[model samples]
Structure formats: C-alpha cells, structure tokens
Target: MLTTRIRNVDTDAQADAGMQSLNEPDFKALVDSHPKAIMLTAQDGSIAYVNDQFERVTGYRQEEIVGHNPSILSSGMHSREFYIDMWQSLERDKRWEGLIWNRRKNGETYPQWLNIYPVEHEGGAFYTGVFMDVGELTANDERLAALAYYDPLTELPNRTLFQEFLKARACQREPADRCFAVLFIDLDFFKSVNDLHGHDYGDRVLKQAAVCIQGVLRKGDLVARLSGDEFAAIVELQEPSEINAVCERMASAFRKPVSVDFREYFLSASVGAALYPRHAESASDLLLKADRAMYAAKTAGRACYRVYSAEESEQGQHQQMLSEALVASLKVAPEEFSVMYQPQYDLRSGAMVGMEALMRWRHPELGAVSPGEFVPLAEQRGLIHELTEQLVRCITRDLTRHDFGTHGNMRLAINISARQIADDRLEVLLEPFFTRLQLAGWCPELEITETHLMNLSPRCLDKLRDFGKRGVMVAIDDFGTGYSSLAYLHALPVHVLKIDRQFVQRLGPDSRDSRIVSAILGIADALELEVVAEGIETEAQKAKLQELNCHRGQGFLMARPTPLESLVRQATSG
Candidate 1:
C-alpha cells in the first residue's frame, strides 16, 4: 500500500509528456526545489549546479559555487589522506555515503551526512552530492561523553576517566624516559562540614578545592575527584627531585580559607604519593600505593604529605590482613574481644569517680594487639562502625553484670571516633545499649578527641546535643593536642576536658609544661568545665596537679586498666 508522487523528476514519463530530455532550466528548477542540499559536480570535481537547500545550508549562492571546486567547503578537519581515500572509494563504487566536516560560506564549520552519486546524462557525467546538517547529533554525543566521564558537581575528571587516563599514560610511555606521580588527597574534617551545613555547601567546598588543586598543578597534569572528600592527581615529573616541591605547593594552596555562602572554612589535607615504575607497574597498583601512603599521612596526624616506601607497602598489606581477621573475629567469637576500665580518681577525695573503657583485642597468633595499631586501620577500612557497635554492646553487657552503678553509681567513659560522629545512625546504634545499661540516671560520658570536635559539622553537633539531652556527658580527650578555636569552644556543649598526656608527663616544679597545664586548668575553671589529667605515673605529677587545684586525674600509678570483675571488686572494697 505505498503511494507514489511524480513531480518534476527527469524520468522516462517526463520525456513522454513533452520533454525529450532535461534542459538547463528544468534541471535548475528541480535542483533548486529539492529539500536536501544537493550539488552537481563535473567529473573533474568542479561544481555545476546547487539546490536552494545547498545555498541555505552552506551560506553560499549558486553563482559563488557553480564554477569553483568543491574544495571551497573543505574545513581542514580531514587530512589529505582522508580525502584521497574518500575519492578512491567514490571512483571504485560510483557512490559515496559518509559523515564529513565542511566549511560554510559564513566561515563556520559544521558536520553533515553526505551522499554522492555518479550519473551520466546526455550532456556529460557529473557527481551529485546531497548533504544534511548533523551538528545537533554531534553535539549530543559530546554531551553524553561529558556526562559519562566528568563529575557533575565539580566538573572535574571522575574516577572512571582518571583510571582510563592513567591506563593510557602507563601504556604509551617508556618507563625510563619519564616518571609520573600519583597523589591521593583526603580532606580533613570535610565530613563534619558536610554534616553540619548541608550537602550543597559541601559541594561548593569540593568544587573550590578542585579549583585550588588545579591552580597549583602544571598544564599537563590531571586532577580527579575519586570519591567523597577524596581527590587524586597525576603529575608529570621531569625528575624525582621535583615531587617534594610540587607536593608542598599543593598542600600550601588549602592553607588559605575557602569562603562559601558567607562562611569561611579552613581545610587541611593529607596527601600520599607514589611514583611511576618505582612503586608500581600498573595504574591500579600505583593508585593503591598512593592511597596507602595517604592513610599513613592521616595517621601521622593530618595536614601533611607522605611518599610511598617499600616498608609502608609491606605494613599496609599486613594491616589489610589484620583487618580481614578482625572482621572474621567479630562474628566467630565475639567474646574474644574485651573492654577494660581504667580508673579515674578525684585527687581531693582519693576515690574513683569514673572509669574509661578501653578496647583490647587478643589474636591467637599475634597475641595482644594494641588499639593504636588497629584502630586507625579499622577506620580507614570502613570497619570502625562495626567495631564501635561491637564495643558498645560488650561494654553495656559488662556494666550490667558488674552492677558498678548500684555499688557507687560511677560514670563510664568511652572514646568515639570522627567517623562515628559523622554516621547518621549513631543515635540509633547507642539508644538500645544506653537503655539497657541504665544505672538509674547516671549517663556514661563519651570522650571525643579534640580534632573530632573541631571538625564536627552542624549535623554531628545536633546528634551530640541529642545525646546530651539524654543525660550523656561529652568530654574532649587530649584537649590541647588539636586546633580548637575559642569560637567553637564557646559554642560546644561539652562537660570535661582531659589534658593530653604529653603536657602531663612533663609536669614538674617549674617546667614550661607546668605553666601550660596551669593555663589549661585556668581556662577550664573559667568555662566551668571539669578537668582530668591523663598519663599520671608519678606522685610528683599528681602532687603538682593537686597543687594547681586540678582535682581529678587518671594514671598507671593509681591502677592499671583491669577487667570488670577486678574493677567491681576495687570499687566495692575501697
């Protein structure tokens, strides 16, 4: 059921109706009326006639194009070889259909779908080409590419594009001729900002950070956003000597405050780096090594950078193995993990007021593994949440069994990590545990490090405030060790400040630390906050603290961390 329409086509029917052959006027009328951009060319490639569509699409008039070569539309996008091959195909097959970039009379370049057919007529043989603009399709393809390989927020290269670029660079270059470095950067306290303000604010910060990073890098270098608060870069190095300066430059850029939405935020980054061929042979391995080094920088207390070493690589692998074993241990035998309470005493009363619950792990082969060694690794490996949950459950169970609350109603202190604070489920995780561990209304105090507090976002603060409303006490641990500002200190809802062990260990008759401790104690007194001195192993330190009017303290000299039974017995007997 196809219908046919015969217009001005130069067919046999047209010859039978009055025209013996197509004259110049008939050809011109037909070509001009055609919808497509049709062009008639001589066998020598000279233009003969053009349709109205051709004049409109190419911005060329019939007189301007009729006698000249079609090379006037050449855009220079295709090379000589391309045109030569195209002409060869047309000559061999007598037709050509392909995509081409052409120049218009208005000096603009555009893409077109072109079809050329060779035909022999009464006067001569000519090639007739018909083309349609395909510019929108080309633009759509580019947009799709951008969406596929670029981050929408920052407009930077994302992980997928980064991996492809790394692979390309790795394969195309000779290892000996050039060396490249992969740097992994993790922004400190970024989670707190994201949680406090809003994701929109966090996005603004990330985009600004990306710009800052790009500003510090060289022209050929590539920067990419790997994930949340984490970015990676590929730096082309002329020599190994250039890496230190480059890393330093990168770290210094964030030293300036980033202003977004009328709020200024200070950012510190931990940068880890690995070089090409020396540290790894593959792109994935290079990135992994850089990540390991970056975590090492974070462990070194952040706001720093570290270069990958063979020793660190070995340690990283060992840490990974330990992390796997730790995960398995959580499920197989939960009882193997234990929490010991370290007694904190009132200096004036000579009685225990509270106990800090410290987590201890015992591996069958590794013996007793210190919390310092595995805690950060667990945090990095995304095991901190699980570890914290397990610890809370264990401690609550032990507290109920000991009935320490009934004996003396002493407060319990547990450490909380930054990751835990940033977790949206933190309140949900601890609610049931707190409900079970209820010793009337005596709430356990949660000890958060100073760094964790300074970095807490509004959301985290809100969560902390919720805990406070439930009678939970918030204590800042290792008080003087982090970047705490008066602005935050005045607004933070905190109960206790634990003086860092370093300042306490140096306490003496007239040492500089004595004055520092005095100043910290004075600050605490002014703020009406209770102070606790940590790491007191000597009587002199305790006497000095007492002399300074610091009433509460904890140390190995008083009593080493012990199990629930021992702690309960001590509390009952004394």
Candidate 2:
C-alpha cells in the first residue's frame, strides 16, 4: 500500500504532500534526514520513493527518478553474471549487501557500499536499498594495498609482488613465447656500508640504489627490492643479447659513487641473469637459476655480471637430482641416517669430558655422503628441520640403549642448526631429552655456530638462556669464523667456545694463527668460559693448544667421529 501510494505521487507537489501519508511523519523525516542514501522500489522494479539523501547523492530529484528502473544508475562496470549473483542472493536471503559502482545523474561513476532488503506490504513486495559513497574508503584501501605490495624504504615492489607479477606475466603469454629475463642483483660490500656508517646512511644508500637501478631498466620492465641489499628485475627482451646489455647497464649504473651527507662511497653490484623458457619453464625455477648465477658471479669476484651458463645449468641439475633423492630417502629410508659421537677431551687431565654428536648419511646408491656437502643442501631445501628431528631421535635412542650417562660425568653436545634453534618444534622435541639428562646429573650441551648465534633474535637468545637456567649448556661452535664479535661473547649465554679448525690447524710458534688462538684463550679465561679447540690433528697441535691453556680439545688426534655402537664396543674391549 505504501509503495502504491508513493508511486502514484510522481509530481513534486504531490510527492511532498504524499510523503507523510506514505509513512509516519516522524519516520518520513528520519528517513529523509538519514546520512545514507535510500531508495524504495516497487515489486515491478520501478523506483517508488527516494529519500532526500538519495537525491543529493545521485544528483537526481525525486520526481525525476520516480517510476524509473534502478538500472538507470548502472555504471556498466560489472558483468551480467555479477548482477545475476546479486539478485540470486537477494531472492534467497531477502537481503543483500556489497560494494557496487553506480553512475550519478552527471554521468560520474562512484563506488558505494550498498545494502538491500525486501519489504512485504498489502500492495506488493517492495525492495529498500540503503547505500553510501565510499570513495574515501576506496582510497584508504588503495593505500593499504600499496603498503602490502611494496618495500617502504625503497618504495619498490617487494618479493611478494615481484613473484605475483612474474607469475602473471608468464601466464599472459604462450609458453613458447615467454621471452624474458630475471636478473638477481646483489650489492657488493654493502654490509660494510652499514657497518661503517650505521643503518640510517645504509637506508639512504638503498633508496638511491633503487633509483639508479630503475634508471637502467626499460619503462615496461619491473624492478623490485627482494630484500636487504638485494634487488631483482623482470626484463622484456627481443633476443638473448638484450639481457646481457641490460645487465651491463645495471652494473655501469652502480659504478657512480653514492653520495650521502656530502660524502662519497663507491658500491658495485653483482648481477646474474636467467632467461625464461630457455633456462627454466617456471618462474620459481628461473628465479633460483638467477640466484645461483648471482652467487657464481660473487665467487668470481664482485662488480660483474654472469649469464646462466651450461655449467651452472649442469650443477643446478645435479643439485635437483640430489634434492629429489634426499627427499625420497627421508620419506622411505630414514634408517640410512645415523648418529656418530666424537669424544671431547680435557687436555690437562687427558680425560674424556664430553662427546659431540655428528650426523652421518649412507645412501644406498651414493655410499657415504659428507655432512659438509648434504647438510647445507638440506638447509637450502628446507629439509634441515626434519633431518634434525630424525637425528635427535637416533641420538636419544642410542644414548638410552648404551646408558651413556654411566660413563662418569660425560657431557653430551649436539650440534643445533640455526634453522632448528629458531624452530619452536625443536624445543618440544628436545624437552624430554633435557629432562632425562637433568635427572642423570649430566649437563646436555647445544652447539650453535658462532655465525648463527650472532644472527639469532633476542627471542632465540632468551630461549638459550632459559635452557641455561634448566642446566643445559650452550656452546658456540666454530668460534672466530663468523662475526666473532666480543659484544656477543659477553652478551650471549654461552658455556664453551670451540676454536675453529682453520685457526687451530695453523697453530705454530710465533705464527699469526697461534697468536689469534692465544688471544681467544685469553678472552675466554677473562670471561670465565670454557674453551674447546676443534680439529686438532697432530701431537704438536694438541700440545700447542695445551700450552695456550685451552684445556679442552676434540680432533682426530684424540678420537674421530664413530657410531655410538662402535664407541660402546671399543669401551667394552678396553
């Protein structure tokens, strides 16, 4: 009845008179003054009544719009299927709410947040639509999108957006016609810039570097900041030579000194290029090839570019094969992996004070795979966590079966990878072993590389400290090989420092390494921490370490890494 009355009052004068009659006067006033625009349509889909806000928002007077279909405001931006879905929802649920684009009387398109509800009356069913222009909200959404898809410091597309664009661009063309190159660019000696000048100056250099890189790329190309001191570009090319030309231009761009605070600093870039469809079929594979090529360039010495070559491709293929084989071995043949323990000795007393657990893999086809070779590979393939868990299980089982704690106050040290230390699951996995060792009066030690220790977050350091409180010792393995900062040496919750083999093997009278080792021992003594010299191969090296008061050492001279069963057998024989 209300719809019929409103529809009949089409003239402006009649509409004004009929508005109060169509509904309560207070209700009509409230609807008219409401902030949101409102429209009422008859069951036949013709506009019946519109509130004052609706006329102002749509730029159409009530009399002019009455009796017209709501489609008169359509922006034609939505497909037919979109409208079909909207109507289907309205019919099924009696209400619909969504964002829509509509045109005003002046032909200006604007986005609106709209809500529609069905009303039943004596005359027929009416539909009421309430909406508001959301142009400002849309602008805010765009700002949020930019934040998500860009690196704030350099204002370049981040890794997420770069990968998205790479995938999208690949999809837009046929596989055979996917002619492009991905260039992985790493700034050489950029860490020294941050180390020498602080992060503020480093940030300014990165921003300038971004501008310089973009200057070398074509208008249609995309360059993104992949991470700190690293950038990647998607380059369109007509031929393979064009990729080389682009890389040379990028290298040349960095030859110019970066200026900060009237000071000049020279920085060069190592660029690696891999072509699409030629190097790899997928974007991820292409990016990996580019990264590998970039590392090769860095190895060749900085400030140069290297195209992905057949040699690199062959190496990549070998790595791929190894990765696949490793995955299969992990899933189907975990028994191929076992734990070996090497005794750590007290050089002064000639007593075995500790044993370090080492991981050994014997593949059926590959024979003995060196931990040096496969361990880093496992880390890169994200299989390190799984491997570490398996090793933990094997070590715990061996310790329990052999009753290793019965061998006097022997401490057990397990090498923990950075990945494992950062993984929360690792704490859960090692908790039971910690409890067992605590009950047995044996101090269990976790050996983290000095490099990883320095890079660890405060949270990870806190975790190590918590372990210390629980009587678990934290030892820094391969000390002096990484940052070796005295700052962390004082700050980290460490119990022992294992001198790296590199420094230990060169120990001699008046040699630089011997002095370095002496300095390390002095620092450890001043800090009241224990020291273990690694890789002692000869009587002279062991004697030199003892002369330096290193006290504890582990090497082939004392004992090589052997399976727990073999070590137990040797003890039984003795």
Candidate 3:
C-alpha cells in the first residue's frame, strides 16, 4: 500500500508518504499485469508505488524502490532541464509521450520509451509513467546486416545509402514544405589517426565520436554515417531559425576532447549543410551540392561548417559533367585523339632541332581540350597508361610524314610517367610502335618529369635501362624541381635535361639566373647529355643560351606549339 496525502504536496509528505499506500488503486498491479515497468509518483516526484516490472528492470524490490525519490533511477542521461520541463508540463496540463533512460540497480543502463500522464482526483494530482523496453529496437537494428549501404560504425548512411534516403525523403516533401536540411560531416585529418594508431584504434575514435554526437540530437532528427570519416544527418525543421540552433549546438558539442584508450584526443569535423527543396529537387542534386559545401568547409580549414548554395552546386555538376565527358572522349576512335608537335630549335643556327609531341583531344562535346588539363585528370583516374599507349601509336604513325629527317635527322619526344616505367609489359606495349614504324636509333625520345624520376622504383629503373639498351632515348623533362634530381641525372638512363622554364624566365639581367643556367649546362656537359633551355620567349633569353653554349631551346620565341603538320612545315622550311 502506498501512503497517500490528499493535502497540497509537502516536503515531509513527499519524503515519507511513499512508505504507506493511502489505499490508492493498485495501479502498480495493473502495470505488473502488463509486461513493462510502471510507477506511480506523487505531485512532488517521490515514488509512491512500483510494479513488479519496475523491480525486474531496476533490480530492486518494490520495497527497495518504494519511499525512495524517483531520482534513484536517474542515470545522468537526461539534462536537468529535461526533468524540469517534464514536470512543468505535468503541472500545467500533463501527458508527455517520449523516451528516457535510467540505470539498473547494478548500474547498467538502457533506454525506455515512456508515456506519462497526470492522474487527478477530487483530492489531488499524481503522475503515472508507463515505459517499455526499447532494447529490442536497437537489437534488431544492429543484427540486421544494416543495409550494406550504411557505414556501420557511426550508423550513418553511406553515399549510396544517402542517395537512396534522399530520394525517398525528397518524394515525401510537399511543395509548401521546403524546410528540411541535409548535413555532411567530415572528420578532419582522420587519416592521421589511422596512420598513427592503426585503423582498429581509428574505428574506436569514430564510434566514440558517434556517441558524443548523439548527445546533441533532438527528437525526429536522423544522423547517419556517410562513409569513412564522413557522417550525414537530416534535420527536419519547421522553421529556418531552428537550423542555426541545431547546427550551432552540434558544432559546439565537439568542443570537449574525446577520450579513447585512456588518453584524451582532440578531433574536429567540417560540416556542409544544404536545405531540401530549396537547394535541390532531386537526390543527386542535393548530395552533389552538400558535397561541394563540405569541400568549402574543408578548404576554409577544419572545424567549420558551410551551407550549400544553388550556384555552387550547379558549377560543381558542370565540372563533373565536363570531367565525365573528358573521360568518355578517350574511348572514341583513335583519330579523334590527336597529337600537336611543338618544335624545339637550335638557338645559334635558328634551325629546328626536335619536336615534343604534345597531346590534344578534340572531344565531341568539349572541343580542343589541352594535354595540361586532361593529363592530370587521366593520371588521377588512372587512365594515363591508356593515354600514353594512344600517344605511342600516334607518334609512330606521325614519324612517317616528318620532313625533319632532312635537318640532320630529328626525333620526336613523347612524355611518359612513373606508371609507365613500373610496367614489365611496357616494352611489350612499345614493341608495336617500334616494329610498325621501324624504330631506328633515337627515332623517338621518351620524356619524363622530375616527379617521375624521384618516384622510380628499381624495377622501373631497370625498365628505363632496358629502353636505353633498345635504342630508346630517355630525357628528364623538367630538371630542377625535385631535390638531387640533377645528381640522379647520370644514374638515370637520360640523354637530355630540359631546363625547367624557371631558370630561363630570369635570364635577361639576373646573373644569378645566368649562373644557374650555366651550372646546369656544365652538369649536362660533364654527363655527355644534351641540355635544352625551355620557355625561351625573349630573343635576349635565346641569345644568352647561345652564349652559355646551350644548343637547343623551345618556347613562344620560336613559335607557339603548332600542329604536327605545321611543325613539319616549319622544321622543313628552316
């Protein structure tokens, strides 16, 4: 029996009245009859009665729980404001349906969905709370192989999952409701955690991060892990001001350091957010814009957030389409992808020396894409080798029409990369060009950049050596970019050091530039390799090369890079 007090709720009554039931209806028994925990509390929040379900959930007997303040069940999960607000609602009208968490007698805690209502009589008012175990909700959530589309650690949706979620969510929105927002969260420098402590530890850091994030969430908000080091959330708001409040709270919650493995670690996230219906009508549009906004946050430096704008997203989509088109262009007929030869000339004699076969693509949609643009893109997309193969075939074909054979025998140089040097089948790939064009001694020079030389493996070095033995001339395209590259000149199978344009730009009055150019020439002279001063646009820069005994150069001073046919005409005319 619960002690009953009909009078206004008092401190002494609140403290002791729970010991004796005032013949109050056996509501606790009703709760026990059903299978979930139930409790009856007086107007002041002291437990007056508890059902057997409550005892089982909290590991306390009815007696142990009775007469105690309901605070015994508090697991420090809810804020002081949470309890204050719940009671305030009871004092006013009463009836709150939501979830709360509490600790068991043994100290383990779990969540419960609660329905609290005011029990009023002619005598006084009381609160009755009925709670069901939500353990199963999360249980089934975890056991179900959680759609492969989600990032498991954060329970955040992956990109594929996000796209599907966005699509479904977008269709649900009405034209009038344009208030929902999508946020993309990226863990800044998260790779360093994996590199320094191993991925296992990195996974823990990420999971811990998720728990901290959950602390800031309001009801009806959905947060999903987008991918490794990236998280996404959908904030459903009825008003625009709510967006700022939600984002600010979420960003600030990351202020305290994360505790992992008995150590404190600091981590920050960059958040890119976009409003639904406002920024995009389609799923891909929403995601693409959010991604750009995230990149903006990252670019601005970490621990920041940016909202997506329509214009930014459109520009990003345009770039994606362009990049996609550039990739598709490469698969067309070989004739669509052509080479433009830039003629290198002998400075003293003013006669054309050799030609550098530069790549050009007359893409169907995007016409006349340059090598500088597509080459970097291809390298990233790992299409450089295929592009190079196409180049070899083109150069081999163009050699037949070259009138440069009249000017003391000139060769065409084609650029290659570290990727080409590592391939054992590279020589095999070149055999077609060599055999088809009858690769005579030094018929084509293979050009490589400073980066290619620095990254070369021993197998790659051996491959370059093999090319040298096969009468393939190798030239280091840019000389002074990487450290000790000049030192590696002889060890490399290179026959030419194309002085990077940096030295030539300063040649007019700077003796420092002149000396640097002179030093490079002396090194090349000692190594018995040729030196070509690149980007010699001024006649003064060109005549200075003659003074330094540098024999060859290429730049606008000779002529802007011309097509192979024009290159043949110019070299032959000279």
Clashing pairs in 3: 1-21, 2-20, 2-21, 2-22, 3-20, 3-21, 156-224, 156-225, 157-225
Per-residue lDDT over 68-149 for candidate 2, one digit per residue giving the tens place of the 0 to 100 score = 8888898765556556667778779988876677889999876566788876543345678998765433223455353355
Name the 10 consecutive residues with the lowest summed lDDT in model 3: 1-10
Better of 1 and 2 by TM-score: 1
Over 1-574, each residue of candidate 1 has an lDDT whose tens digit, in order, gives 0001112434545333322233458666877787678987654446767788888899999878875878788776555555666677877998776656778988887656678777656646567788776443322345535335566677766787678567645543454767989999988878767777888899899988888888989987988898898999999998876888888887778777878877788888888899887889688999999999887777677788889987876776677678888888777867768998898999988888888889988988778888998787677666787788778977877866876646355677888786688776777887776665554544578899998788777888888888888778899999999988776787888989999999999998999999999998888888889999999999999999999989689999898999988977765886
lDDT by candidate, in order shown: 0.78, 0.80, 0.70
Model 1 bad stretches (over 4 Å) = 1-178, 184-214, 222-233, 253-270, 277-288, 325-333, 378-383, 418-424, 431-443, 455-470, 482-492, 571-574
Task: Give model 1's TM-score versus the native structure.
Answer: 0.64
Candidate 1, after superposition: displacement of residue 156 in Å? 6.4
| Candidate achieving the largest TM-score | 1
Per-residue lDDT of candidate 3, residues 1-574 (tens digit): 1122233565655434443443446743455687667877776656767787777777889778866777777766454555666666655775765556667889887656667876654344567777755543332364236334446566554565456446545655244744788777777757657876899999999999887666777666667776787777777888655766766666666667779989776788777777777777666777767788876665555577778866655655555565677667667667777777778888779777777888878876678776766786676455777888788777767766663455454766888877666655667787667555434434667888976687777778888887778666788887877665556666887888889998898896567989988988899888998888889889899888999999789998887877667766754666
Ranking of models by lDDT: 2, 1, 3
